[model samples]
Target: MIIVYHNPRCRKSRETLDLVQQSGETFEIIEYLKTPLDTSGLKALLNKLKMEPAALVRTGEALWKEKYRGKDLTDGQILAAMEAHPILMERPVVVKGDRAILGRPPEKVLELL
Candidate 1:
């Protein structure tokens, strides 16, 4: 099944959700901001995404800039920060089984379908 880590406030996240719906596939949406992911879950997602904890972070976000930017943070520290502040995590991270993708441009989710 396809699972989308969605943030309804994000334009790209909304666009990606629309694309998934148009694809006529069953999918699950995780509004991670409302229901946050634990450290292990986030780590597993990072593994599926083939990314480091920092890579899954939205560094451009105000929280990141204010709290984490230009800081020498380890992967564990970043993961902890993400767990504590879900907004630091990027939006529309789509996953299908063992694979996952960051749907930055939105259309990238089509790759999984």
Candidate 2:
């Protein structure tokens, strides 16, 4: 089974979802904007992604820049920020079992499939 942390508003996310659907594999989509992940959930996701909390953040988002930029935040602080503002989380995070990948180019998700 696969899980996709998706934001339908994002084109890349939509494209990634299309690819996932075409693959005909059992998958689930979590709309992070509507149903945000808690701190522990974020931690588990980061563990699967093999990434630091900061790496999973969408730093370019206005919410992040306005509220969290240049503050020298700890890992916990970063996760808190993402929990407080789901927009700060990166889109189209595709996970399968113990591993995960960000679908930056959409095609990158193919590697996981």
Candidate 3:
């Protein structure tokens, strides 16, 4: 089974979801904005993704630029920020088994298939 941490408002995320649907693979879509991940959950996701907390952050978001940019933050701090603001998280994180990847270009989800 594949799990997609999706943001419907994001074009890339929507595209990724479409691809997953077209592939006819069993998948679950998690709208993280409506139901945010807790710190531990985020940590687990990061482990699956083999990604640092900073790598999961959407640094281009205005909230990040205004509040978190230029700050030297620890991994915990970054995770806390993402929890507090789910919009800060990067979109279309696709997971299969223990592995996960960000679907920035949408096509990246194909790797899992």
Per-residue lDDT tens digits for candidate 3, residues 7-102, read 998899999999989988899999999999999999999999899999999999999999999999999999999999999999989999999989
Model 2 Cα lDDT, one tens digit per residue, 32-101: 9999999999999999889999999998998888888999999999999999999999988999989999
> Which regions in candidate 2 have their CA more than 4 angstroms from the true location?
none
lDDT of 1 by residue, 21-97 (tens): 99998999999999999999999999999998988999999999998899999999999999999989998899999
Cα-lDDT of candidate 1:
0.94
Q: In model 2, where is the ten-residue run with the lowest total lDDT? A: 59-68
TM-scores for all candidates: the values are 0.97, 0.97, 0.97
**Candidate 3, poorest ten consecutive residues by summed lDDT:** 104-113
Candidate 3 versus truth, CA RMSD in Å, comes to 0.7
Error of 3 at 60 (Å): 0.5
